[model samples]
Target: MRAAAATTFTVPAELSAAEPPEVRGVPRDGVRLLVARGHGPLRHTTFRNLPSALRRGDLVVVNTSDTEPAAVDGHRPDAPAADAPPVTLHVSGPAPDELFVVELRTPDGRRVLDGRAGESIRLPGGVVATLMAGHPDPRVSTGSRLWRARIAVAGGLRAWLAEVGRPIRYSYLRGDWPLDAYRTVFATPGPEFASAEMPSAARPFTPEVLAGLRRRGVGVAELVLHTGVSSLEAGEVPLPERYRVPTATADLVNATRAAGGRVVAVGTTVTRALETVADPGGLVRPGAGWTHLVLGPDRPARVVDGLVTGWHEPTASHLLLLEAVAGTALVGRAYAAAVDRGYLWHEFGDSCLLLPIRTVHRAE
Candidate 1:
């Protein structure tokens, strides 16, 4: 059985979903889902069938991080060319001492790798984003990207972002989608808390799915993990992001597991948060703050028994986390089947549910 962490395959450009399912004449939960379990034949179904797929006693955990308008146009004040393209500044998240983890993107959506320290980019409303040193450390080579920058606006930063910022867009996504299209049903609605990018694995969930889960007796819980920009260089560990796991949810997780009910995480974000506060012997504790945990073969999942997630890029570091949560062989087979079956990729794409053949829990 080949491990997914070591297995690599090409995802065709045609399979990348250019827009939301609604724009493509499909419902939010109408996207395809491929279910993978231990050495069994893969099951093909739509995302809305999720409640019927799992047992009644199983608990579904979701991330409550809201999507932020992180993208804003800026240009270097010292640029020599008069017709130079606008530099797209992506506000990643907060760093120490009021600094923010930011990235400069070219007009075509490529990372600006040649950014030097002390460079200032002019923003709308006379705001200025001054680039500081490389984020985390100067030694971490992120394709020579990401900086701790200071963006000063007229009012507060939050007020300025809501006024001028838009959702971060990628070259793969064709349309300039509105911020609402990037949000998940479970995202927290407060302006004080926001994810630089959507916790997109949960994007397929709709009100219909929620009602079905309730009818089927599946319990739901929530935590928050405000994500940073998700572009990761090969072999680059993901940067630290803010997260909060509540005591109520933690207690519920332990209770569910003790009764032999599966603890299913809705996305990699929730899995990371749950695993961050989990103790040895698979007990979950409530906690809040930044999490630096990176799940790989070295540290497999101890709490989550199943995962619902989106199809990831071939080189994405998130693939390793899937291997850690649901044995590598399961992930490999699922990805292989997804590619062969024309499953779409990215935030606007289809999804997968990884369950490495757990014992069945009888309905209560």
Candidate 2:
């Protein structure tokens, strides 16, 4: 599937956030927020002021799929360490036939497109990942950005990750951080449940921010979308992802929209999950399954009225989702203003609140 036209602006190097806001002597909620209300001009503020952006009856849905330490270093055991350079494997998730969708990257974060099937990567704690085939299509063996691999580890992959793996990060990010730094306040506690990368929109939402939202009478809803690797090559559509929208969340969304209040999704993940379970009339139902939904100008959001999201790469599919919730004009304007004002980019960067004048109007 081809992507509809969305924002395709360039982000400057200085605007890319390289580390957590805490490392920069700023609280997570202190990151800048760009407000793009359809009827009004763009306004800039801090993330801590998010609650005031919406009305009292508004419902904010958040993704609880926590970030996992999925990046692990491995090398082929058959070759000498000198001959076989260690490859960093970013595990997406378990695939069919007990295989896992994995991307092998060099230490410098460059995609290793040369991964071949039958290659065994020896990892710490007796974990060995064997590449089975190229992902999406097993027939295409070479030049695949992602590979279908099987991991044989003690206990399980989740448990093994806790001990040795780090969060998957791109080269724009500087240095390594503990797994804790990659998690959001809404991330479910414990080890078994996690997303390959952080559900970054909620990263700046601290406990204090939650308290503020509650105090303002805004409802917080929950969902889970175990996201895969977000660094897909430009023009590559996102693969199917597992998501769950609970009965309570669906009920709240319907109630809020029915009463003329907005349902604000915390991120593109939330938007996708909610839209997947929503009916043509904008009513949502509880459901859990893999979603291949691609929101864009052609398939705009059906239930969500507003969005609280992070900056996305110009070519990234998430931008298409943004264009679905907010109109293309508003999204393009917001991104232009963000770039002009030097707002940060990436998971660790700033946030944007997109409130389109009208969100849902089913085709006649």
Candidate 3:
């Protein structure tokens, strides 16, 4: 399949890429959340008000896959002993078998680190990653200086990251906040194996919001999509990361359909997981596996009828997944509304909740 290409909406470098809303302080569940119908315009609301937006019997599928400090400072194994450029190994995904996909870069040139597959690089706190085979060029733009590759991590992965790695904060954040802020309240205790940034949807639905959903008859299910480091370097094409949808979540997805309820993916990560497991009938089946599926206009969505997600920049590949659900026209409308009305962008910004066309009626 043709890789989903980048859009014009990616925030330009000149635009201030700060994360927090201007003049606002942090609140765990208080970020803005917008709701849009498949064929309608965007509506604004805070995340705490999510239960009011959905009906009973709607199922919310969340990605429980936590974030990892995939970005590490390292030196090139092949570089000359003294003058080797200080390199950053931005981890991406595991290829078929145990091999990994990693991005390697230096002041001189950028390339994938493959020749030393299985060689261990000790991190700041004794954590090590066994270098693995490299995969395709996941670059979205030409002339990018950063490269994509993968690696096999060793030791208590989560613990190791906490000790040595900085939270792989996106460039827009200006400075890094505590990694804890990036993660969801429900994140599994272990170190994240894949995603570079925390999938933000799980952020808003705290225990209280979740209980409210449950009381209102909403069913919650968890899926895993270990995300890799985002290829957000200037002029770089977005890269694909490793992802997995566990069997139990798949079953809940199917069950939600059988019960005639909406299957609502909580974030792009969950959307990617469910889309990976879809069959010819557009139904999701039970499975625990990896995926490199890139959803966009060309890729028809099968499992999710609606989605709740953050307001990503135009360049973010996540928008392609949203296009799959809302269609290009609807996405354009929602985005226009988001920008015109001053909706915050990025993980710490506002969110958008999209409903399927059939459910959102427009009176003439």
What is the TM-score of each predicted model, taking all chains together? 0.95, 0.96, 0.78
Per-residue lDDT tens digits for candidate 3, residues 19-39, read 544325756567777788865
Worst 10 residues of 1 by lDDT: 355-364
- Candidate 2 — which residues are off by over 4 angstroms? 190-193, 359-364
**Model 1 per-residue lDDT at 9:** 87
lDDT string for model 1 (224-274, tens) is 999999987777888898888999999999889888899999999999999
lDDT of each candidate versus the true structure: 0.88, 0.88, 0.65
Can you give the lDDT of residue 49 in candidate 1?
A: 97
Clashes of each: 0, 0, 17
- lDDT for 264 in candidate 3 is 87
> Higher-TM-score candidate among 1 and 2?
2
Better of 2 and 3 by lDDT: 2
* Candidate 3 runs further than 4 Å off: 1-23, 39-41, 75-84, 96-99, 105-134, 137-159, 190-194, 232-244, 359-364
For residues 1-364, could you state the per-residue lDDT of candidate 2 as single tens digits?
Answer: 5764657688889999999999999999999999999987899999999998988988999999888899999886557877878789999987888789999898898988777888888888777898889988899677788889988776888888888988999999998888889999988955444699999999999889999999999999999988999987777777889998989888888888877788999998999999999887887999998898887766778898999999998778888888888888999999999999999999899999999997444323
Query: RMSD to native for every prediction?
Result: 3.0, 2.0, 5.4
Model 1 gets an lDDT of 0.88
